[model samples]
Target: MNPLEKVIWILVAYVFGCLNGAYYVGKLYYQQDIRELGSTNAGARNAGRVFSRSAFIVTVIIDAWKVIIPLWIAISFWEMDTIILGCMAIALLLGHLWPVQLGFRGGKGVVVYLATALMLAPIPLVVCGLIILLGYQLHKNLMLIAMIGFSSIPLNLFIFYRNIELTVVFFMMLSVVVIMHRNGD
Candidate 1:
């Protein structure tokens, strides 16, 4: 594909990623801002706390779909290449980490990360899930568990996909997650 088309797909994925379900659902349904809530995370976990149980489920679903849909369209419909897919994947994570609609403050990228892993490499995601579970049993901190889980994303991509581009994409996404979650919650 041409450079322009790649740029367009990246932009489109970024825009779709910017649509934070927790932020919007909280604002529309509860008249509250998720950014002001626990951890100030515009993701499902905080959404469950600030909004409702159902909101949490919905936000997770939306977050996953928000990334998955664009990826599907690009791969299945547009038949884009894997390298371009990697670019758009990074753009999606960046959008979630620092959405334009929220003045650049956004979630910690757990949903985006999991969705990305599920889409590109399911077995690795499962392995990471086991790591997270084991970490949780040992320490029992959700953030820590997530950190343990997310830290494996790049390696998981490499193990499952064996694509340098995808591995780099997950590494960058994980980097964004680490940066966004620097503060203790």
Candidate 2:
């Protein structure tokens, strides 16, 4: 793709990412901002803690679908290159974590990463999910469980895909989400 088209695609992904599901769901369903409830942040776990199960489900669907739709459109329909795909992945996460609408505050960013990883590597994501499930059962620490889950992406990329740039992208995305969640925003 040309430079201008690449920038436009990345910008589209970024804007789509800025659609904070948890924040909006909370506001619409309960008339209360999700960031001001429970953990006082706009994230899946916080949304689950504060809102109903159905509301949390909607938030998850929104988060995942927002990434998946544009990504699928770009890759399958638009046929974007690896670099543009990587840019979309990074931009989506950044927008999710630091949306301008929320005053540069947004979700923990794990779901967005999960969606990206799932789209890029479903088998690895499955294995990672199982491991995370087991870890959650053993330790009961959400943060640690997520970190362990996120670790599988890099492992999958290095082992299965063997793409250095993608490996690096997975590592960076994992770090960003983990740090965002740990830092409480």
Candidate 3:
């Protein structure tokens, strides 16, 4: 495809990614805007806070699919390539966090961030999950837990997959995720 076409597809994916499905789901099911509630995020965590655990589960499922589906579509249909898919994943994560449809603001996108990382490389994802859970259990602080998990990305890269490219990708993605999560505190 030409550069113009690639740019268009990327933009389309970003726009689609910014849909805020969880927010709509919350509004439709519970008659509430998730952002107006708990953590004031249009994502699953806050939805789960004000709504039901089931809603949070559903939100996560949809949120994961959002990134996966777009990447899959671009890879299969547009033949854009995996690197672009990674870029699209970041775009989707940012989109979910700052949805244009919702005044360019949304959730923390941690679930989606890890979901993207998992799709990119499973081992790091697993390690990160374990670290986050363990840290949360020990500290009872989500930010601290996330920081521990985020900090462990390099160890996860060294211990599991030794691919330098994968390591760099994981770390870069982790950095973006952490930056996006700055507001979590």
lDDT winner = 2
lDDT (tens digit, per residue) of candidate 3 on 1-185: 77777777677667766877669887789887777787776877777778888988998888888778777777678777655666677677668877888998787767767777766667777787888887787898877777788767656776666766556655676677678667763
Tens digit of per-residue lDDT, candidate 2, span 67-168:
999999998998887778888999999999888889988887888999998887677789889988999988988677868888988888898879777788
Q: Given candidate 2, what's the lDDT at residue 57?
A: 89
Candidate number with greatest TM-score: 2
Q: Against the true structure, candidate 3 has what lDDT?
A: 0.74
For residue 49, give model 3's deviation from the true position in Å. Answer: 0.8
- lDDT tens readout by residue for model 1, 23-66: 98898888999999887888888899877899999999989999
- True lDDT of residue 173, candidate 3: 62
For each candidate, the alpha-carbon lDDT, in order, equals 0.85, 0.86, 0.74
Q: Which stretches of candidate 2 lie above 4 Å from their native place?
A: 183-185
Weakest 10 consecutive residues, lDDT, candidate 1?
176-185
Q: For all candidates, what are the clash counts?
A: 0, 0, 0
What's the candidate order when arranged by decreasing lDDT? 2, 1, 3
TM-score of 1: 0.90
**Ranked candidates (TM-score, high to low):** 2, 1, 3
